[model samples]
Target: MVVFFDSLQGVLVILVMIVIGYILARSRWFSPSSSQIIARIVTQIALPMYMIDTITKDFTKQQLAQLLPNLKYPVISMMILFGLSVAIARLLHVRKNRRGLFQSMFFNSNTVFVGLPINMALFGPSSLPYVLVYYMANTTFFWTLGTYLIQRDGEGTWKFDIFTTLKKVFSPPLFGFMIGVVLVLLDVKIPTFIASDLHYMGALTIPLSMIFIGIAIEKAGLRNIKLSRYSLGVLAGRFILAPILMSLLLWRADVPQLMKQVFILQSAMPVMTNAPVVAKLYGADADYAAIMVTESTILSLIAVPILMTLLQK
Candidate 1:
């Protein structure tokens, strides 16, 4: 009981920042380009620095080794979710235009934007390597299979660009992580000045990420949201199904408790923020994707605290 409230308090701390962004976006304080600007700064700039700072500082070679294998858990979990997404899509009789997009959004999560900040707030920097591991698995799958499926929805044929897929997979943050890992393996240490700069720049990740979510919500329009079988099905996949499946997969695994907790929490995050962009780019229903993002992101505030309490027990 107390645990739940404590978790709620942590989420509320995050909510305050999100509310600030929501207000700013609503009041026209944030321009149309604000979300894109913030996202680029967070992903291309802030997140990579954060990855380097945490990975280089907090993780040792042995610890990184232990963490790498755990990636398989999230990969396996997502694969199961992917299969279930197909089954649920057919069961729901989702439209052909939106069916592939539906399955993509159902299985992929907002791992970096939502997952990182919440994990840091709940578990601190020590949870980072585990978080990165999950991010690696989640990002790879989302870019490759997830994006391909979404593209298929738009094109209605087997269409995949390996060059584009590879570019997405080996993203800036992953490059940062790889650099950190290489330095660790090579026994190289960053100079004090450079490390300090990275730390300062990395500090922007959390608050900016939360604000991005807020902007996304505003862009999606709260009035536009409506409950339907499709939304309900996605809600089930994210809030209920994903976490439960993660728990089952991790139940008997030999790993750190924090790893288990972080994995479970991350598994159930909102639909990917990139969903709408991909849907729109590929000529699918961007509005539907946007609604799913808004719906899942809003519900995750409630879901996170509840999931936290369960993780505590």
Candidate 2:
């Protein structure tokens, strides 16, 4: 219990950074548009750099062989949990109009935006391969499998173009993933000067993303909106219940300690921000998606730290 509390201290520092961003956003020191630019920069530029740097520096055949036996545990664990979360959202009786948004909420997480930094900070360079694997697992699943469930039976009166959705898989960050893999495969050597510059740029991704999250929350007016029990229920499922249940199952399955921690931590993360984007595109409840992302994000400060403390022990 004492160790748990001490580990919670690390989580608190991260929460404080988010709170500072929120305060700045509410004060109008930064506009939502600018905050979005920060997110875009991070997502399009900084995050990809981080991914490239991590992957290019570390991947090797021997490491792959060692991780082969355990790789399925974390990746499959996430797929199952994502599935269960969506099933619960469907079961909750959210109105038909809102169901797609709610389902997307459960279908995705803020892993790339938030999870990367936390993993890097807490576990250091040692967890880079797991991070890469997690990225591949989550993004592949989201663009392909996750999209089908969201658009398959919707009332949008629109054609569900799997091709267009598949195009999203080649997003800038993902393209970076491909480039990173190529560099690793060819054993491309980055010079000291260029590598150092990219590393410096990559460092800004998480903090900038957090600021964007704050600005998004302020613009969305989550605090002023009336909370439905249903919304709260969804948030509870994402932030509170899901991680605990999933972590236990993975632990019992004898997954590696680092991968177990990564899975649990990612599960504890807030609902994905781009969920609203997907909702709007698919003619779902964009407003509800915005609300879920905001509320879950705020609550995750409490939820993640508590869950981290519990699991780390």
Candidate 3:
């Protein structure tokens, strides 16, 4: 019971930030364009800084080596989940218009925005490296295969572009992570003043991220979210099967307890917040994607506390 309450306390911290964003958005403080701005700042500026700061300061070479091998756990889990999502989509006869988005959402996750904070809340700062390991896999897959499927849902055909795929895959956050890793491997030292700057800038990542999510939910309009076979399918994929698959993969593996917990928690995160944007860009069902983003994010609040309780046990 104490563990459950402690876990709930962590979730409550997240809920409060979300609510602030929701309220401020309702007041029209955040324009529709604001989600884009906040996302850019977080992903491009704040998140990268966070990575550089954490990696250069907090992580050790030994920890980095161990973290790299464990990347297989998330990558393999996502691949299996992708296959299963395809099966479920077929079984349900999901419409071609939104089917690609459905499967994409099922297999991918909001690793940075929702997953990061929740893990931080539940497990504290130590969970950051494990969360980043999962993020690397999630981001690469999303930019390549994930976006391709989203494009498939559009009116036009999607031709594969290696350069474009590579650009997106090696995104700013990932690049920041890469730079940090290199710095660590070379055993280089960051100047004290610059390190302080990185710390201040990186601090914006979480609160702003939560606020962006709230604004996104507000923009999507909660009333528009309803469970269809498609939404339910996505729900099952995210909240149920994803974690189970991750757990199975990690079951016999020798790894740190924190890594296992972060992996499982990340596996159950909501649909990638980028889903609707990519859908809109591709001329697919952006509204459907937006609704699922809202729906799954809302449900994850409920799901996290429950899962955390079980994990605490």
- In model 2, residue pairs whose N, Cα or C atoms come closer than 3 Å (at least 3 residues apart or on different chains), thus clashing, are none
Residue pairs with backbone atoms closer than 3 Å in model 1 (clashes): none
Cα deviation at 76, candidate 2, in Å, is 3.5
lDDT of 2 by residue, 172-269 (tens): 77777677777766778989887887788877877887677767777778655567866776676677666766666786775568777877777667
lDDT of 3 by residue, 182-296 (tens): 8998999999999999999999999999999999989999899889999999999999999989988988888988898999999999999998999999999999999999999
Query: Residue 189 error for model 3, in Å?
Result: 1.6
Candidate 1 accuracy as TM-score: 0.97
Model 2: residues >4 Å from true position, as ranges? 58-61, 64-71, 78-87, 145-155, 225-227, 252-255
| Candidate 1 wrong stretches, greater than 4 Å | 155-158
Worst 10 residues of 3 by lDDT: 304-313
Per-candidate TM-score against the hidden true structure: 0.97, 0.85, 0.98
Q: Residue 56's C-alpha lDDT in candidate 2? A: 70
Q: Give the TM-score of candidate 3.
A: 0.98
Q: What is the lDDT of candidate 3?
A: 0.91
